[model samples]
Target: MDKYRDRSNTLAKERLTRETDKQASQNMAQWLEEFEATKDRVSEIKRVKSRDEDRYYELLDELEITPEYDRYEIIKGYKRDVDALTKEWLKATTPAQRDSCVQAIIGLKSDMVRELMNTQQ
Candidate 1:
């Protein structure tokens, strides 16, 4: 009777493992299907982002914005600091980092130059 019970337990364990693995496989398949379905939307968003970036860059090019023209040493220092921050922002993945960097470089809700030279010690 004990030997029979042990065999039954082993079979039960094997069956449970198989069922868990099967469920996991099904979940992965569903996830892949969902990802495939969103491909078009993802592509559209990426294209829009590319266009927007290109336009922003073109504006910068037309404006010829640079730090080299600033005559004051303090303003040049601010430009350098802002430039470094903007470079970090270009590589940032999170929205918060991007927003903060942009705000630091460009004044909030205004195209006018911000006073950052005084902040630097």
Candidate 2:
């Protein structure tokens, strides 16, 4: 009777484990589908943004407009974001906080064009 009871308990434990795994698998599958869809949309947006930025710069070149820069030759603009992110990065004390600051900086850099500066001082 003891051996039979132990066997039944084992079987019940396996059944519960399988059920939990099945639910987790279902959730993961749904999340994967959403992730792929979002990834594709992001790629599309990047392509369009690239095309538009190129067109805008080309027009500026054709119109004989020269873009000016500051002391370091970096473009000057009203960047509330740079201030916010600088504060966040300075105040970040955890790995997760630092990682978020890194991500934000990378995202901000993506939209900027690298400017060539004259070094014939």
Clash pairs, candidate 2, are none
Candidate 1 residues lying further than 4 Å off, grouped into runs, are: 1-70, 107-121
Please list the residue runs of candidate 2 whose C-alpha ends up more than 4 Å from where it truly belongs after superposition: 1-65, 69-74, 114-121
TM-score for each model: 0.29, 0.32
Strongest candidate by TM-score: 2
Give residue 23's error in model 2 in angstroms. 41
Residue lDDT tens for model 1, 1-121: 9899778756744553344324434342343344344444344545665669776555445333333212132333444565565557656789898767665554421221223222222
User: Per-residue CA lDDT of candidate 2, range 4-115, in tens?
Assistant: 9778756754553344324434342343344455445445545665669776555545433322222122322313564466567656789899678656654543332222
Query: Per-residue lDDT for 20 in model 1?
Result: 34
